[model samples]
Every structure is written in C-alpha cells, then in structure tokens.
Target: MQLNKQNLTAFAGKLPCPDYDRGHLQTGIVHIGVGGFHRSHQAYYVHQLLKDGTPEWGITGVGLREGDRAMAEVLQAQDGLYTLVNQRPNGTNSSEIIGSIRDYLLAPDNPDAVIQRMAHPKTKIVSLTITEGGYNLNAATEEFDLTNPDVQYEIAHPQEPRTVFGYLAAALRKRKAGGHPAFTVLSCDNIQHNGNVARRMLLAFARHQDPELAGWIEKEVTFPNSMVDRITPVTTPEVSEYLFREFELEDGWPVVCEPFIQWVVEDNFVNGRPPLETVGVQFVPDVSPYEKMKIRLLNAGHSVLGIPGALHGHPTIDACMRDKVFAGFMRAFMDQEVTPILDPVAGIDLEAYKDQLEARFANPNIRDGVGRICSESSAKLPKFLQPTLRENLRRGGEIHRATFILAAWCYYSDQRHNEKNEPLEILDERAAQLHRAAAGTTTDPISFLRQESIFGDLSEQPRFVEAYTEAVRLVYDRGDVRSLMADW
Candidate 1:
C-alpha cells in the first residue's frame, strides 16, 4: 500500500496511523524549510497534538529554495502524509504515520501564495528550522547581512520576495495593515538563543525596507526561543526501500531517526499558541540553560568524534564509538572541557545526560554519517566548539583534546581524504578558503588558525597557539589520528 491519506486504514494494523480525521484539520502554523529534521521533530510534535483531538495547529510547510521542490513533490503526492521510523539502540524498530502537515507550497514557484497564507488571520505561529547559517547574519557583527545580493533583491522588490526574512517582513506588514494581530515567530534551530537571533535578523531586514514596519514588528511580534533535539539523518533511497520491503508501504520520502526526541521552548507568544506542553513539550520561562547544555555537549561531542573519526576513515558515528579509544576521547572532552563551562540546567542531571548522549551515539542501527556531522564545520565550530575553547581559555582549563580536534580539522580540510586515500567530500561554504589556509600550514604552522572570521584572535593567544602548534605537528608528522588520540 502507498503512504497517503487513503492508505491510513491499510497501514492501521501494521503501524501506528493518525487516529483523527485530517480533512477537518485547519492550518494554524506556517513552518519554513520542510527538511527531514523538521518532519521528524516539529512536525512529529504537532502530529501528537493532532492525534489528541486538537486540529487547529495543522502545519502548512513552505520551501523557499529550488532544492525544496523535490520535497514538495513527495509530500504533495502523499497527501501530506509520510512514515516516521524510529530505530532503537536495542535493534528494534517502531514506525508511525504523521499527518499534521496539511499542505506544502514551494515559495519559488508562488511567493505571493506563501505570503498570503501567513497573512491569513488563522495562522497564529510561523516556525522555522532553516539551519544555523540560514539566518544570514554577518559572522563578525552578528547582524543581518543586508549586503547579500538576494537580500538586496528582496529589499528592492518585496512583492517578489525570495528569502525567509523577505517573506516574513512582507507578511507581517500585510497583517499590520489589515488590522490583524501579529503572529508569534518560533525558531526551532539548534543555535543558542535562537529566537533572539531570529528577531534581530528579521528586524534588520525589515528596517532596511521600512522603519515604521520594523517598529511595529519589534513591538508586537514575539520570537520564542526553542531547543529541538532529534537524530534524523538524510533520507536515502535505502530508507525508502526498507519501508517497502518490511512494511509493504511505498513512501517516496520517509524519515528515519533515533528513538530520542526533545523540545524545550520559551512560553511566550503574541497570539494564541498550541497546547504543546501537554504533548511532552517543555514550556519553560527560560530556555538558555537547556540550549547551552545541549549545544555544548551533544553537538560538540559529535564534532570531537567526527573530525578525527573521519580522518581515521570511520564511516559512521557508531563505527567511531565502537573503537574504545575514540569513545574515551569523546567522554574526556565532555567531562574535562565542556562540562565545566555549562550553567546548571534546571532538573537535568548532567552526568546522566552525558551517558544518554554516549548511548545515542553508539547506537549501531542509526548509521549517522561522520561526513554529515563534519560537513559544515566552519559554521558549526563557531557555535558549538569555539565557545567552549573561549571559556576554557579564560579559566585555564584542559584544552589538549579540543586543540587536537582543531588540528584534525585542518588536516581534514587540507587532505580532503581519509587515511585509506578515499576522498572525503568537503561540503562547507568556505571550503576553498579553508583549503588555502591549510595549504600554508607547513610554513606558517598556525595558518589555519589565522582565519580570523572563525578563530577570532584565538591564534594570538599564547596558550592556544602553543597547544595548536604541537597538535598540528603531531598530526602531520605521525600521520595517525587514532594513535595520537590514544596517547592523548
């Protein structure tokens, strides 16, 4: 049976299907960037609320880029229904069909339609999962990049908006003009204080277009900070094949993830919000401690293993964890360097959270790729790893393992291949610049650290420079990351 609204009855006996009638569902939320993580995390949470008889929070997904056309095709063909498979550490599988997404619109195809949907009075919340770099903030100034060509175009022609900020500013302007109340802007990205970042970027863009409109948004709108956690990998053809072979369900783009999921959100909204708190969503007064803890530990832990593990030719995170030396290095980096910098997260046991992260990484069934974790290091390291290094430098803490990881990244960027000589696909936006810096490592020794946008004067710090120089020398001279990690 195919996965669609019509086939829910067919999948009922085999897997968990939506129990409510989706036809009567209304759209109260407009979510941008409908990727695997959105489907598995935010969409999944909304699906739970739908199952509990709250039909007002159905989502209308918007895809801004041309790459999102593929997802648009899949979800539209499936009648906004898709299968979500949870791979457990114990080798068991659980699957469910999520039905909260009522419609999808590719913005490049019809930008006006997308804006009008958000301007509608019923759409109370506009959410985003547009990745860390999607906000278009300048790295040094941490302000919206008004110099971007697309942003300039959007500012010149707001009616034909091409970016998220453009569309948001246009829609909010319409809402204010039509005497409609402003909707809450919720950001579910992994960045610390994501809501604040979103608000700043959007306001910068809005002010560039119209100062009066920007003031209205600042006074009326609320960007609720949120921390969303899930281990959803890219949906490969093998995943679709597995769904077909095991459950006889032909899904074009089914999402697969680990069995762990979490969402901690600030309880602040302008218009009415969903009863998400009743569905395992923690609605707290402050989300800073929770966001800080997750980013420093789980996200940084991935980088600690991913950079060296990729150089050592580990295919997946589980493969790295299978090696005792890599596993020990991961734990040591967290306990010695990261844990000390974190503030006390209310009601969370730090040690137990660390244990849970280890178990999640070691789950063989998840097959979370090392390349995926290492792809966008330029953007990720600034947020995830560098903060810990900055804090450690101030307090004089252990920086050996963290410094070595940076060395491993330089070598990885320079070589672009594993020990086995197989090419590692470098996917960062700054790949060319990274390779250029890494090429000068032999002569300068700290050339890679000189990328001021990334390192931000850390190269000039004596302690960091000493540790980095030693680590880079070892990486090149010995040519064995596993042995270096074991000895460290």
Candidate 2:
C-alpha cells in the first residue's frame, strides 16, 4: 500500500484526480529560482491544475547555480515526481507525487536550451523566486550593479550567462527577434513592487549592455506585480520521513509547508495562462495594497521578531513566540508601531490580520529560520522599518521600540557578544563601515546609529537621531534586550 505516483492519485480526501493524462501536460511557464518555496507554492498550484485536467500550464524550471543543478537532478531522477506535505499544528495533509515540472534547465549545462525555451512562442509566463539579495542590487538605489563580477561576465558574454537578469534579458532579446509575443515576468519574491524591481534591474542591465534591447523590452514586456505568501522551510530528513511514512512514497525532494497559501496576481498575460483562478489564485487589477500589507505587516513583523528572538537563544519562530516577552513585543510592534500608518486593504480587517499573524507565528510545525529573515538587513531595513519610522517621526510619535530593534541589529551584526561567543555572520555590504563606527565599548552608542545608509536621511533629523542614540546606549549598557524598554 505504498503511495507511489500510482497510488497517490487519491491520497487527499478532498483532492481529486484529473480526467486527462498528466504526462501529456506540456510546459507553458519558465520559472526561475526553482527552489523550495517555488516547488511548494507555485508548483503545487500547477499540480492542482493538472489534477483538474488543465494541462497547458506545466512548468520548465530553470536553476541558476550548481546547488540548483542538484535539485534538478533529484527531480529528474524521480521522473519529475515529488510530494508536498501541508501541515498545521493540529494535523497534516499530503499531495500526490507532483508531475507538473516537465523539465529543468541547468544554465551552465545548456544555456541555449533555456534561451530557446524562453524564446518559445508558447511560454507565456516567466516567474522568479530569487531572493532579494540575488538581484545583486545597490542597496540605496535599488538598481542592478553592473560592476558586480557576475553582471560584468553576463554583459561580456551574452550567451551562456548565469545571472537572472542576464538570462531574462537574453531571452527577451530572442523573443523580440523571433517576432514572438512577449511574456509576463511575474515576480514571486517578497520585495515591494517586486515586478517593478525586476523590470528596473533587467531593463537597466539591458540598457547598459544593449540600448536597443531595452527599447524592445519597454515596448514588449509585461512585468506584472504579484504578492505571494507561504511558509515553507528547507527540506530535511524529518520532512522526508514524514512524507515517506504518511504518503508511502520515497520522494527525494519533498516540500513541506504550512496549510496557509496566498497568491494575488495581476490579470494580464501575453501568451495565455492556466485557469489558476479555478485553483484559488486571485486575479486582481493591482497587487500593491496587498503587497504593502504583507511586506510592511507580515514580513516586517518577522524581521522585527527574528533577531531579538534568535539572540535570546530561541530556535524556531514558534518557540520564540511562546515566550511571553516575545509575544508582547510582537503585539506592541504591530499595534503601537506598524498599524497606525498602514492603510488597510479593501476587505482586510487590521485586528484580524494581527490575530492571524500571531497564529501563524505560533505554528510549531513550521520552523522558519531566523537567519533567513536576517539576511540583507541593509536592503531589508529601508523597506521594512524605515517607512514606519518616518511616519512615526513625522507625527512626533515615540519610536523607542523601533530604535531598540535597530540597536539589536547592530549588536547582532557586531557579534562580539553572541551567547555562543562566536562572531556573527554579518552579510551586509556596509559591514566594515558599520563595524568601525561601532568600535570601542562606549555608553554613548549613536556612533553605530549614525549609519546614513540604513538610517537614511532621517538620521539628520535631530529628534530621530537623539532617540536612536539613546536607544542604542540603553540597550548596550543594560545588556538585556527586554530591559532596553521597561514597558514590555
């Protein structure tokens, strides 16, 4: 009774089989950054379409690096088969072996193959899940850095390129030459107006390399904004074991995620797309409001909690949330700090949204990484914290809490005092400067707080600068994250 693809068809009581042949499903989408989240989220939706006899939207996944090649190898050996395990605190559910990924492209192995596929008349959508840092962008300008060695290599040799922007620009050039209709470049990353960010980088890269191609892209491409959400972690043996025992399949690359999922997409397509609305994908006129809500609220909330929680020696989000102090910190950060400035989406209840966030954070089964949230703090801070800080400062509201959060970040990045006594693995571009600014044990700690890139022009404002200075001083001297503020 082992649940291989054959027996897994009806594994879910609610999930039914397609009336047609899933193997006949052909590739219509070329997905970039085919990692765990893309596999668990977008691929899961496509698999649902397959189960309902929609075969036109199968994916040809493209991996940008050697690590991706290993993932591709696993899926290819399993015959493009994998399982998705969805769990909640109370129970679990599983998907049959997914076959929606028709093929994978290793950029180094066959860049031509990927280029040809992207240039294909039938490939309607090009989706991306490359993390924020992968954009290789200038943190201040939000533009691609042509000076980056990867970008320089991609520029010099257009063929057999490695960067996402390079591959995308090359593929679009092919389509433009082929007289093929342009594809929609849907961004599935968590960045704000990610479609715009992707467009800015790609077009900027193209303009630097070839101005004509940039013009063609402006005329032909549809970079639609999207907001995607899910909580899927890196796959581990415990997850593989869960899939094997529950589904009775030995999937080499299984994706386990929380039960919650959301995708709000712009209703524009060039070559055509799946009936994904039938599978709960919301096609909307705009995704900005939704994007802001998720980014400022959900993602910012995670960033707010992640460092403090990690420094306190909490292993997972749930474990951190279980501590009364952490829970209260989340509430105050959301209610007192983040919510006041947020304009609620049309149907969203701010209170209920807060409640759901708390519930999601408390889901013990979903072990989201502290490090994952901590990466690219230089890029992330402006988007996540600076906005709220500006709004609060404009109103002369107290931002002591937000300031303390920044102090925590500086300390964490400083790494001189991690409980393990190991140095912090800071990944920021401004690390050396920030380290020098923070040098010497002093009670008047605005030296580090004066980082203009992170604090922005707002650091010039006397009130905001004073508050940040005092907050850093208090936290460093007290040596207790909670004691930095007596209220919480």
Query: Best lDDT goes to which candidate?
Result: 1
Pairs of colliding residues, candidate 2? none
- Compute the lDDT for candidate 2: 0.77
Q: Give a tens-digit lDDT track for model 1, residues 268-329.
A: 99999999988899999999999999998999899999999999999999999999999999
TM per model?
0.98, 0.90
- The superposed Cα distance between candidate 1 and the true structure at residue 86, in angstroms, equals 0.5
Give the best candidate by TM-score: 1
Distance from true location, Cα of 427 in model 1, Å: 1.5
| Candidate 1 local distance difference test against the native | 0.92
Alpha-carbon runs more than 4 Å astray in model 1: none
User: In candidate 2, where is summed lDDT lowest over 10 consecutive residues?
Assistant: 11-20
lDDT of 2 by residue, 411-478 (tens): 77665455555455566666677677676427446666566645657657788778777766666766
